[model samples]
Target: MKHIWPIAVMALALAACEAPPSQEDAPFEPQYLGIETRLLEGDLVNFHVEMRGARKTRDIEDYARCAAAQYALIRGYGFAQHVRTQVEQREGLWMADAAYLISDALPKGVTNIDAEVTVAACRETNIPTV
Candidate 1:
């Protein structure tokens, strides 16, 4: 009986370790990766980018990686440095807050226009992804 229990435990351990392949290997619509962008245009354009989704896994690393990627993309363009970012998990979604600043090279405008643009457009718009 003792030997039988040991073998069963080993089998269960192996099964638990075997997580299925990643989405890259198999194409599946990503549950997360939705972005919310609010652009404040004027002398300095403030881009507030964040991740919108629930928290299924307690993967802090994943959220941090997402933030890094977004920050890199925004800085690469010509956005400002960073203003603020807020992150919250509701129900089963994860969220992040990011703000970028455009120090110079702004068009003549006294009014502040919050331009909501997509991530792709943000990169190609010559925003200087620093």
Candidate 2:
């Protein structure tokens, strides 16, 4: 019984050291690279979003879209219309350069995003928005 107690203690110590992966070490999710914004005109802004480990252009584009939506909210707009998005991969990281127009009314045919809702969605999906 004495020998068994020492073995159990060592086992418990090792188990404590082998902690599970934290949120920072999410293997299956794309990590945020960066976000940049430039005001082009009144209610129009250029957004750039880059993400590492994004397997597809859609992933990086979504990040950009999320950024744009959140930015519109920050700028006191209610809706964001996607003007254009250019996606590229460099050095194994995906980057999306996008343009958005913020407006009070939703545009026709374009994928319009509600500023508040999109920001919340980004947070829930682990996408960074600014």
Candidate 3:
């Protein structure tokens, strides 16, 4: 009887400590998906980003842009010019297919684009960038 009581208590404790599945475990709804980049040419990159857990279109686009900005910094660049971005939702995941031209200085005829500023904003918003 003594041994049985101890065994039951141990089993209960283990069960209580079990954690629920995290957002990454399941594929339903919006969760922040990570970015995949492909170098197309000198200073030009293509980014494929995904987000889950949020249904907002603008939020996903911002996540993609943040990724581009961070990527520019990774390549020793201070700015990135937006080439294009295509967004879509499939199987509950918001995907942003984007392209950018990274540059140490702003590309000719390009408006202001600061990688540091974009990365700061991404960190502020809890968005992952690389």
Candidate 4:
């Protein structure tokens, strides 16, 4: 019947217009380039991290955080307070410049991170540290 043919065509058109599957299902393959550490002041330190295949800016930020945690531990510090993190992406390469205050006692901030705990987490998550 004419009505059945029209319905079938409309269904076919609708199916063709359906959106493609989401890219979130793709495997995350991130390559961490390296990290540069600088002593900004007495307790303040800066970390510059670079990576590729980052899913978002948070990935680069996390990389910097991991570096800061490990760096603090290396310096015999027990805690680090996050100051700021700047992230940029260029041509599939992501970079973050992060600052943290390394301290023996817990810093007075909401962003304070336990170096030992953070380093352990980073290792468990397969993220490299400085």
Candidate 5:
């Protein structure tokens, strides 16, 4: 009986100490910020691939995750992930925006796109619709 009471109390104490999931615990959601026709950085990447983690900026551990997000951005654009990309930063709901800059000339299908491409998870960019 004494041992049972101690075990029960220990279990209750451990359960009380368990932390709830934070924004950092959230999964990665794909995001993109549509820039003006002129902002695609030339032909290859017309849309700035902006990604934010479910966690806030303070939770960002390193540039590698940002880099992966950049690659994912290019992949999100229906382009090959062969090219190099750089990650930039901005504020976000839980995490900061990671901007992947594609430095090469975009392929023909990518250049001069008239409409914005969207995915299920991306937060919409505020480009005025004509």
Candidate 6:
């Protein structure tokens, strides 16, 4: 009887120590607002993306990436290299400022993206592209 009570108490303590479900476990319901493209320089482009209900910063970054990929394809570029991305959230709105270098050939970097492939993926994921 005493041993059973102690075991029950230990089990309750262990259950209490278990971590709660994380935010990542929540269903993603992203609302993409829009994308703005800027020609920073020759072959360099900047994308400003806005959205809501983003699960995290990566969601906004991916939105910007999709815009950059489509823009590169429209500009007759086959590839783009990721340069930088800055993300912020305010009043439930998420925004990302991202830069990429569009090129006719594959850029020299691990972060390079093939425009066609990226655009296809974005479409498959139901993400909009410019």
87-107: candidate 3 lDDT, tens digit per residue: 998777788898988999878
lDDT of 5 by residue, 1-130 (tens): 7689999999999999999877556765534332222224442332223335524432231222333333434444432222333444556522222323332334354322211232211224221220
Can you give the lDDT of residue 106 in candidate 2?
Answer: 80
Q: What's the TM-score of every candidate structure?
A: 0.34, 0.75, 0.72, 0.89, 0.32, 0.86
- Model 4, backbone clash pairs (residues 3+ apart or across chains), number: 0
* 10 residues in a row with least lDDT, candidate 3: 22-31
User: What is the lDDT for 21 in model 3?
Assistant: 73
Model 1 lDDT tens row, 19-116: 88763465423254544445556432333222333223323223433333354444454223434555566754555554545433332445211222
**Candidate 5 local lDDT, residue 12:** 98
Candidate 1 weakest ten by summed lDDT: 111-120
lDDT of 4 by residue, 1-130 (tens): 8689999999999999998865455678999999999999999999999999888788888899999999999999999999999998899889899999999998787999999999999999889999
Candidate 2: deviation at residue 53, Å? 0.7
How large an RMSD does model 4 have? Answer: 1.8
Against the unseen true structure, what C-alpha lDDT does each candidate score?
A: 0.42, 0.85, 0.84, 0.92, 0.36, 0.94
What is the Cα-based lDDT of residue 127 in candidate 3? 86
Q: List the residue pairs that clash in candidate 4.
A: none
State the weakest 10-residue window (summed lDDT) of model 2: 22-31
lDDT of 2 by residue, 5-119 (tens): 9999999999999979763466666679799999998888998887888766778888998899888888778899988999988887888889998988787865788888988
Candidates by TM-score, descending order: 4, 6, 2, 3, 1, 5
For all the candidates, what are their Cα RMSDs to the real structure?
10.1, 7.8, 10.2, 1.8, 9.2, 1.8
Candidate 4 least-lDDT 10 residues:
19-28
Ranking by lDDT: 6, 4, 2, 3, 1, 5
Instruction: Assess the local accuracy of residue 92 in candidate 6 as a C-alpha lDDT between 0 and 100.
Output: 90
Error of 4 at 71 (Å): 0.4
Clashing pairs in 5: 40-46, 43-106, 44-106, 55-94, 55-95, 56-94, 56-95
Q: Please name the candidate that would achieve the greatest TM-score relative to the true structure.
A: 4
The residue pairs that clash in candidate 2, if any, are none
